[model samples]
Target: MATLLLRFLLKAALAFLAVSVLWVGVYRFVPPPVTFTMLGDVIGGHGITKDWMSLSEMDPDMARAAIAGEDSRFCAHHGFDFRAIGNAALRNAKGGRIRGGSTISQQTAKNAFLFQGGGYVRKAFEAYFTVLIEALWPKRRIMEVYLNIAETGIGTYGANAGSIRYFHHDASRLSASEAGRIAAVLPLPKKRAAISPTGFVRRHGNTLSRRVATVRDQGLDACLR
Candidate 1:
């Protein structure tokens, strides 16, 4: 019985590894139509809205804004930012609601491949997928995919979808400030609105706008360019 169980477990492990590798490899070239987050929304009967746009199809300003707002060191890091992770761990150790310090690459991997939230098992998958994407996909592709799949609002996904729903404009035409607002809400999209100027969002958007310029001036966003 022990021998039989070991064989079954070994087979299952191998199967999982193969599927994970193949799936990540396929998406390196292909645009993913849906993600685990989108699937969850659909299963919960909340209709999903997403319109994938290529990196060039959207405004460069939007990309810069996302970088400034989300991860200013995006171009400098490999797959993870150890400094940010250390800071996050230190903060959590002090006791509070646990927060994440995931980089753009990590978020891209999670959004594209894994589910929204799970315990250690999902985290292990996230780490595996993050490494796969960083190793397999280019930085531009990573940035592009992140912008397109990140949840922007309730039931809304992607830059194009969020732009149309919020500002009634195309993603390519978003002004720096407009793009800033969109990027500002990314951390908590469900509770924030890009169009309406809440005190926090408005201030945060302005900060991102200035940071976008700073990033450009310093060439901190050179990877996307």
Candidate 2:
């Protein structure tokens, strides 16, 4: 029985490995359209289309704002941010409802590897994939994938689609404030519109804008270096 159990586990591990390799290959080579369960609503309601933006063409402002809003220590961390994770744990312990310690790496892992919303098991898988991605992919590649797959607006509007839909411009053309507004809506993309101004979005945008300026002034490249 023990031998049979071990064999089963080994097979499971091999299957997982094969799936991971296939996922990475598809992501790197195929410009396949990623469809999400939640994104369909956003696109249908907003009347937007799909698009992609390369890292070379992406606006520096959008990158900075994303760093500020999602992972302030992204340039310094490998796959996880201990400080943010600890803080999230403490907040959860204190009965805070908004307890997500996921880093940009973790989010990328979840998006790349699994479906949305399945509780702790999904989160565990996300962490596992996060470690794998950090080991196999560069920081730039990770960021690029995050920006490409991240749900930026309510319906099917990803970063590139959201950039064009809301701003009426390409991701490469986003200004600092415009980028901040988009980044601010990330936490609640399903509830917020990137184009329409809400009080919460405006306040968050301001906060992100300040962080972007600080990242710029302090030099984000220095952190990565």
TM-scores, in order shown? 0.93, 0.87
lDDT of 2: 0.77
lDDT per residue (tens digit) for residues 98-143 in model 2: 7677788898887766778899898888888888888777777777
Q: Please tell me which predicted candidate would have the highest lDDT against the true structure.
A: 1
Weakest lDDT window of 10 consecutive positions for candidate 2: 29-38
Give lDDT for model 1.
Answer: 0.89
For candidate 1, write residues 136-201 as lDDT tens digits: 889999988999999999999998899999999889898888889999989999899999868889
In candidate 1, position 162 carries an lDDT of 93
Show model 2 residue runs off by greater than 4 Å: 29-32, 35-48, 95-97, 221-225
- Candidate 1 Cα deviation (angstroms), residue 190: 0.8
